[model samples]
Target: MADTGEQFEASASAFGYLFQFAKALHICIEQWMSGDMAWNVAVEAADDIEIHQGAGDRRLIQLKQRAEGVRMTDLSEDLWKTLRIWAEAAKADRIVLAETRLFLLTTAEIPEGSAAFYLPPRGSQHRDEERALHLLREARKASKATKGPLPKCFEAFDNLDQGDRPLQSPLMSRIEILSGTPDINEVRNALQGLAAFAVGHEAAQAFLARLEGWFYNRVIEQMQTPGGRPVTGSEFDEMLSDLQRQFRYDSLPIDPDISDMSFDPSQAVDQQFVRQLGLIGVGSERIELAVRDYVRAFTQRSRWSGENLLRAGELGKYERKLVEEWRSRFAEMAEELGPEVTEEEKKKEARRIYRWVDLEARFPIRSGCDESFVTKGSYHMLADELKVGWHPDYSARLIALLEPARTR
Candidate 1:
């Protein structure tokens, strides 16, 4: 029989670890947005998350997320374990006691008369640093003969307090117990609140999705590298600015998958867009470029349409604009050549017209849709449909070529 209960318990533990990461990310974003960019946040550094203010000053955070209604009592394991870690760090000289502020952020509530309850900020009604230090010392004494991890916890707690410049009072003074902290889901909601206003209601989800994706990728990279760089507030600001520009009313989000698509020129040799380029005496190199543009434009347009990013009839209007411009240029080229032009001269004129579309034409589907490939590839898309072509006699040549296929 399957042990479903054990499996679910293991899964829950995994989720707790994930929640720590999520909470750390949320805290970084919050601090950055609030203009506290001077500090650099590092995950799993001196603690679960460490915010460094330079000159050896730091804020170390330990996050404890528990089930609803759980309370941080005098003998709570979560309380003792957090104390042990901080005490060990102080004893090892890895942390400067005078320059460090410790934060214990938990989903659990702190009961009155508990060590944690008296360690809130001085402005808090329940705060009493002196009382907190006294309580911790008494608790350490009372647990002197306790077994399991309690003995080591007491030993570490004693080591920090026994030194010439006893760190107990200084450390207790700097510690802040932020009980009743928001859970993972609430933190996500807060992050959404921070982000949604920038992109508007309709596009808020997409904007946040992209932002979080970039953020998580950066986090992963940092985690893999030893002594990784801290994520700065300015970096977040810059990324937010970039995302804002992309999600603006005049701009459409460019799917990297479409724009960065790879293509094989050989594979598209039979494509009509390639044949159109050949009619204008385009070289293999230029034809290959044209094929690439065609694929990108095709894929991108399809993605935009499928995602409903385009307004109804907007693409049709843009295509009509391109075709109209091409028709005028083609007529002018035909008039210049007349009926007496040599084949070479006709091909030269056709290549000139093709160059104009590739180099000089500037038709954007939207004002901020400034990607050159989109315009270039869209022209190729028009050619592939036989609605626009460079060569004056391209229609005749294309019809003749397709007559065999039509017959079949």
Candidate 2:
């Protein structure tokens, strides 16, 4: 398995893309709302923006996206400090612009408990922080209005210098329709789990195997062209040796190491390699299919049929208690198995546990240990384990499983 550095790099890139996407989306929403042919919009902060409307008013908009629900703790104190400074500057700039406004836009409406503090801008610092305090009170009202219901849009605007027209018009319809930032936290958590598995035993081996397979494909691809310099047998051997040295798995017996744990071959194998080979009319697809079949057989064989009994509620209270005790013991055994276990075996165990946890977490059985189990393995092992029976075309299944759980 590879180290955390690669995974961290990948996640960072993904988050960066998400941030850019949010910024572009914010601009799109502004264009859509204002219907103005020309407007100056800038994403001034990660979760906030500054927009100068075509109508010639300076507006500051803050956007927040909370997937699991927003809380008071979700507001960063540093962000508040920054906002305080910005507000002061914005107020000062109002002297030049003749109109200035601030707006807070959120994906999910602010929760009632935290709503009091998110409203429009208040008076200058010298006056009662009443303007800021009033801003909070207005935010609380808005939050209450949108609770448990998704609003079409949300916006708050102020007129700093002009008494003739208020900032309310620009905000009323514009803010609610804007899409919140993409939820990067979800991907981060997923990557964290994957990284943990990479450090484990069986999963690590499987991951290495997948990586090796990927490298092998790259070599083969290079070899096939008419003028291409094919990889010599010695070169291939040397590359394998180098990989083994890098991963420190050359001394281990591949089969026993992977098999002993509960490696899900279907998950661990990189199907993309096989698919690419198939497109080239190569033999890799056949080999991959065979490997997948073997892995599936191994996983099915390792699963405890007894655990299915937990779903029925057929066991008496005493019997149920006994089962829980057995599960605890099994978990302990799994932990011990990690150190002495072959990498392959560790992978298998890790995959089975990871799949079980994933399924349980998504479905949430009322009374079961499925969600509580842990999978431990190296990066390769974890990836393979996570791949359990997952077809390359499993997106439909995932959507089917998740659709019911999503809030409208």
Candidate 3:
């Protein structure tokens, strides 16, 4: 649940995608109606969705929604913008003013009511000329006061040498503010309307199935790749062309049988063997690393489970013993080597040797580790320290000296 408040602006942006998808589906039906060859389309196109017919006719929509309800102010700016864009499109001949339609579709109801803002259809009247004229007057007034889009649009339409001056040419006839209609209901109704065009029962079933699948896949794609800003008409056209070139989604394969699924021993072990190790008190952190290494050696794998969090307390105690014994041996050797090296420098060298040895022992090349990894140490820092202004053979000689003390 969400409200139409400013705090839910991010949620509103997310809603825009869903709204765009719905509008796109509706526009797809329009494409079918127009016998459009190029089904190239997208959401957030100029307004919400735009389509061009084979005969150069264009249809554009600006979609808006509100959680609670919509008002005159909420629609005023959008209407003004749509009028301006349509006028520009007409001026450039990008769309036929007589054939093209510019619509403001909203999920919320007009609080001041559509009757006042829009002219209602009466007996023997097919189109609402009064409402259309009222919208023009309102838009023209809005254009003057707001001094934004509508004014420039009116200018563009006026300067056009065509007979469409004073915003005529049936362009105003093409505009409609469809308010008080829910978006989901509109999409379903649009689909049902398409179902009317289906040939027979089987064809209708196939058509509905296709609609459902297409809706799901496209919506998932939209959700995964969300863009908040509205795109320009040229950008939308280019993107549509690119997508058409890249993807060939004309056919879908039949669903495969689930009973045929089976797993190999290697895959089974890769997935669960690490968990088994963890259950047996191999430290979770170490088992995790081992699983990662196993996958890196073979194929991809998921992270370890929560059930594999059990710690190998015994292995930790034993590793501690290993470190202590090595430290004792190092101390004795340093003491017996005469007073050439200070105790601090000797201890630092011993520490560096121990860290490198610890890493190698934990992740041995050939087989199983004697102790699992509890923590991931900073091996890179040790490597960097060794590389610092030291003799080239320093680390090699140190490793040779400490080889006798290693657990391996």
Candidate 4:
């Protein structure tokens, strides 16, 4: 989604920072992994960035990002272009192909069958170039469903001289693909990984500060050139806003979480999943706390946190209990409110209760953390998934909630 070129300039704007952040992470991590002190990233016509470890140890790092889940079909064209750049660099003696690494860093994971296409189906001892070319041909032949020029480019490359063939005839093992769900957590984790190798806290802080400044400059440059039309200061401001809209947690100031603890599924908004959590004999107060956390996170548009909350609703029986317990409480409260509460008011309460039972029944809570401490981006999901089936009268109220103007 981030790399889709057909988007209007406004839509593609966030990519400026998304891409730079990923590149910076790769640079720091690569430096740590390779123990290469003298390296410059995103320099001198290299793809995304170049990592020069030594004479023959130069590497090309290409960063690709997708806003949604990635598929091989989605990558073909961009992959071709990146491959071409590296292949030409190798051919021109600008870098040694064998010693250089080609890293395809993305924000989406490659699906099962797609992994084999990146290589020769896992087990073949064939050269990477031949394998890359073969996949390219087959991908093109089956390209009726795809949309791009990658297949055609690969076709032409297959016909070129061995030296000029970027992907069709070569022996290179330094190809790697790194992908993950795009979120502040991803960026934070990357920075955390780089922390181990940083010279000190000051150095790490300086690197991040520089990266932020670099992103500001890069966005300005892209805004000015922007292919079709020259950009104005206003447009650059819009880009920054768009970046904040999607990656506010990363792009804005917030305390970072650096703990190595695993993600707690209880943080999700899944009703059934929360019911499962309830199975462990969690108290009502804890569930209420979790629900508040989940609801707040969802209201804040914390996508990853919402996913976690939704996961809780996946287990059937547990969610049912949660829904029943919540509805039962509402019924008791309605009785206490007595006859002044119309049947309509009773059902309205049911709708509200049902929405909660369905969405925000679970929230992330780990040991030693305060009750009010909810992670940024922690949210609810599975709003339609009530532990108990919907009642017709109550459903109307829920529908009304969805369409506020209907009643007003």
lDDT of 3 by residue, 129-160 (tens): 55555555554555435455555666655554
Q: Tell me the spans in candidate 2 whose CA falls farther than 4 Å from its real position.
A: 1-17, 29-35, 45-47, 73-82, 91-98, 107-109, 113-408
**On a 0 to 100 scale, what is the lDDT of residue 166 in model 3?**
56
TM-score of 4: 0.40
Report the C-alpha lDDT of model 2 over 292-314, residue by residue, as the tens digit.
Answer: 43453334223322213122342
**Top candidate by TM-score:** 1
lDDT of 4 at 99: 71
Q: On residues 280-307, what C-alpha lDDT tens digit does candidate 4 reach at each position?
A: 3445665565565455534433433332
Measured against the true structure, the TM-scores of the candidates, in listed sequence, are 0.80, 0.26, 0.40, 0.40
Model 2, residue 22: C-alpha shift (Å): 3.3
Q: Please, what is the whole-model Cα lDDT of each candidate in the order they appear?
A: 0.82, 0.38, 0.47, 0.47
lDDT of 2: 0.38
- Each prediction's total of clashing residue pairs, residues at least 3 apart in sequence or on different chains, is 0, 40, 1, 24
TM-score between model 2 and native:
0.26
RMSD of 2: 24.5
Of the candidates numbered 2 and 3, which has the greater lDDT value?
3
